[model samples]
Target: VAAPARRGRALTAAVVVAALVLFAVGGGAGFALTRALAGASLLPPPSAGAPSLPAITDEAPARVTTASAATANGEQGAEFTIEVGADWTSFLEQRANRGLAPSTVVHLVAPTGGYEVSVQRFADYYPRHSVEDYLSLVRSRWPKGQYFGEATDVTDPLDPAAPEPPVQFSYRTVEKATELGRAADAGGRDLRRSRYSRVLPRGADLWVVEVVFPTEQEEMGRSRLFDTIAGTFAVVG
Candidate 1:
């Protein structure tokens, strides 16, 4: 009877061990199956390295289009005409000076509110001032801590032989604290501005044509829209 009881106890212990082994094997197989169904893997992950990024390339030139004629007349009977996009609206305003000649400003607002071209005509204090001289003054008046690119001479495509070519320069600014920036923020848009300016002598007065637009729309500013304004601008008194 004692031998029989020992055999029974050994058999019971063996059955318990077999059951645990089966449960572990089944559980591991179930976990692997679940991972496979969920698009995961039990294998090691790929080694870390630099992230893949898109290649950079130069942007293609924008298409040229013929602009429509537009004119702005100031209160002092001075007027200027330029070619602008058909969708633009022109507003003329006279700015009075304390003891100097009054100036005229023509704001050409773009359709979508992100771009504007302003034409300003003011008395040239220095009658002999060159484009470079005017540009130096303009640079001095710019707000500090802004990024300004080199000024370049842009020949008038319509009048290539003109003696004084327009001086063109660009600058960038973040307008998060301004009124325009506040409106942009409400609309979930960034208000970082990219501005392009051309300064040239227009008879006794100086003409400064500036284009301001969102930085994301830089290609539009670089298009023939600017070319038409700078090349076809004419002023008369």
Candidate 2:
């Protein structure tokens, strides 16, 4: 009887040890899984407030420089003079960098004062075409509803004996956003006025003097200024 009791007791002790080992293994696996899942949840997501990249619109403005007439009129054979307004240096500047041919002797711009003046020289390549024909070609390029006034004869002090006086044509055009859109719907009144004079001296290279304004409300001011300048314009040769 004592021997059987000893054997039963050993079997019961082995069963309890085996149960404890299985329980410990299962608990360790569960603990490890819980840590992995919780670690993922606690980790922060990617941030959205990082610094923005630089863009093209952030570039600096153009550098402004003074222009001297002596430098502008220094072109080889197209030297000429133009009258400038009083206090002109405060209001206007010559566009030294404007894309013009070497024959384009002078170009002036005044954004605040609202005008642009340019003097260009061209060879008499179109001697067959009359001034009227040339002016018609220019007017044909205007948009619809733009006004093109009649061409007027300009008195050429340099050439009084020519058959017809040099021609001057004036025109007014409104800036069109598109072919179908109305000017009012586009924005404020952006009226444009242009004066083009074909200077025909007896034995001089053909020249064109142009003045333009963004708005016609100040037409008188610009007209007077341009007339003053054109009256004084003289050819070097």
TM-score per candidate, chains pooled: 0.53, 0.49
Clashing pairs in 1: none
Mind sharing the TM-score for model 2? Answer: 0.49
Instruction: Tell how far residue 13 is off in model 1, in angstroms.
Output: 29
lDDT of 1 by residue, 1-237 (tens): 899999999999999999999999999999899999999989878765423322212242322232222224233424556666665677777766444445566788765666678877666433555566655655565466654554475544322443466667667775444444445334433356677777765444556778776666566666645654566666544
- Stretches of candidate 1 off by over 4 Å are 1-77, 95-102, 124-128, 157-165, 178-190
Candidate 2, residues 24-114, lDDT tens digits: the string is 9989777777878777543456554422322211122322233322324454444555655433332222322212222333566553445
In model 2, where do residues sit more than 4 Å from their true spots? 1-76, 85-105, 111-113, 161-164, 177-187, 194-198, 202-204
Residue 55 of model 2 has an lDDT of 27
Cα RMSD, model 1 = 9.8
